[model samples]
Target: MQRSLLLRCSNSIFRPPPNSHRLRPPSLKRQSAPIAASSGAQLPLTFSQNYRTAPNRLHCSVSESQWKQDREMATADEQQDPRIARISSAIRVIPDFPKPGIMFQDITTLLLDTKAFKDTIDLFVERYRDKNISVVAGVEARGFIFGPPIALAIGAKFVPMRKPNKLPGEVISEEYSLEYGTDKMEMHVGAVEAGEHALVIDDLIATGGTLCAAVKLLERVGVHVVECACVIELLGLKGRERLGDRPLFVLVNST
Candidate 1:
């Protein structure tokens, strides 16, 4: 069975780059989780226990008038997510990114907030606590932010999917098209074993070209890519459609 996830994207990665070289920060120290599970299907999240307050026309929690005002925040996940509002505010969207008029969903805002940063990593661990995830593959380079820590939490190895000609080894490569042009991503052939279950991650999904390429690279090695996890998702671009059959998941989404 496919597992359902509620996402609250952290906005630290979307910050306007001060320097291209310093795009990603250091690896996070592993933290202990208050959970015990080996697979996602085995983990059962109780909705009643997760929601703090009931939704209704009440002043104490949320009033009908207030809900009307916050209509932009009416997605299924946002409505029930305990961390939606906080994470949304943490994500600072810039007016133009890579070009003009493109409001990029940045993760740097969430990275700066210690509370949001840790919560994002910790939350990922909880959701996949039960999945017998053998490896956590982070796409260069933003995926490195949360992927390593989550891997440590679940006792998994951290792997990298880097651009072509970067990894100095016997690499297996796959070519694909990006939003701008053609591109390629490669992984070390020895990095993953045949039949291993891999969880691919990235900071965000826009056109999904890069992710599709990474999935293809993993499949060539006979690795079973159980799912893909990303922090933010820009909807209406058909990003999810690019990833067929693979479980594409996001913490926060903006259409």
Candidate 2:
């Protein structure tokens, strides 16, 4: 029964109904404890367990209606933002990209549209501007694209959280789980100082593993991560839940 429910949830996320641009919320609720595996079954490792073990985490209890209303208000706000439409339309979806059973949200197309790309950065800048954000920590690769511009616009330093030995100086690293193994994200030791306000930037949030790792990396150095911002969010994955009390801001929800 559990397997069936998991399969159904996956299907609902990746296989939306025809003519549907928005995804309906999945029916499966999140389990508090890890599900027990059947005999001889090997369960995949997840980052949620590790995230929960961290100290001083803030937990909130929000009612379902309140959560829905908050989401609705956010959506309405996006609708009012002129950049939202252009950013959403410029993104291209490629089926079975990088692997089968994946519907990849491609942002390269958005990069090609100069106006849309600028609008994307401008939207982020508007939010962080005058918020006293001093450090913009961008996760590797795609984060590199959006982070620099926002950092420059907001008069903040751009810190790169890279993979493995990408950085030349002394660095600190945080590792997170993958399907078959684990991966690490590293940051320069002195790139940011204690008590500095930070904002984490990434292109997308699926299972939240990368963003979670980024947060942990920043926090280790005593940086206060104001919030995480992504270009697109896969709503069915419930990545927001993995972030605990850290708020997430996104321009598009590809449910």
Candidate 3:
């Protein structure tokens, strides 16, 4: 059978092997103990039991499964979180922010509200509960505001992917373009361990160029980009299209 096309275009192209499929053990949900292989078969005296084993993944597998299960629970949509709803409603449309004919969704009003700020982080934490995110990489300025606490709540390491010389160390940089201007984002090589799964977090996505650069930087340091989550998506900027198959999770779609 073909890979789930929805999943392909949604999250980055990750099609697990058939054996790795998440399946409910077909039996009864009862106790957790040893049982005979069959009704008539005798249980082995010294059973060679490894309940949940996935090489190089003893830790990763457990974390990933648990997180996914958390996500499977009813998602906390914007309506459910009154704070999120309030924040969404309070987005003041500023005409010509930074340029002509650009009405930016001003988050300053939302940020000042304590409830709204907390809800925004909570929503993001819940949305990615099942992705076994090893690290949360937030961009400079506003990104730092929401990223750290989310990492602490989810038990993931927080790495700051900064702008230009903001990071004080030997860094890996990637230059990308945006609708209004171009800029470069950088990350320290030692921020995250190689092969760690990283979730990129940001306040908004208008062009997606910065986030893309962060992803590339994480890759350069050997981290697999697992997902990208945003607080708000700008109108008509189809940053999602530019992201292709990467997992892009967001709380608000302004468009």
Most accurate candidate by TM-score: 2
lDDT (Cα, tens digit) per residue for candidate 2, span 1-255: 011000001111122113322222245332222322323333331111111112221233445565455455556666577578678767666533455334566689899899999999988898899889999999888999999999999999999999998999998999987655788889988899999999999998776778899999999989899989988776545566668777788877655
lDDT of 1: 0.62
Candidate 2 has its poorest 10 consecutive residues by lDDT at: 1-10
Model 3 lDDT per residue over 1-255, tens place: 110101111332222223322122345232223323223343222111111111121111224454334233213443355555555654444433445333445568677777777777777777766778889999776678889999998889899988898878898888876434567888887778888998998877655667777888888878898888777654234455456666787655443
* Model 2: CA > 4 A from native: 1-71
lDDT of each: 0.62, 0.68, 0.59
Which candidate's lDDT is highest? 2
Q: Give the clashing pairs for model 2.
A: none
Every model's TM-score = 0.70, 0.74, 0.66
Report the error of model 1 at residue 46, Å. 35
Compose the digit string of candidate 1's lDDT tens values, residues 1-255. 011234533211221112221111235222222221222222221110100011111112334454333333345566686565566556655432455324455678788888778878876898777889899999888888889999999999999999889999998888886434566788887999989998899987765777778888888888898788887665434456557556776776554
Off by over 4 Å in 1: 1-76
Full candidate order by lDDT, most accurate first = 2, 1, 3
**Model 3: CA > 4 A from native:** 1-83, 179-182
In candidate 3, the residue pairs with backbone N, CA or C atoms under 3 Å apart (3 or more residues apart, or in different chains) clash, namely 11-247, 12-246, 67-130, 68-130
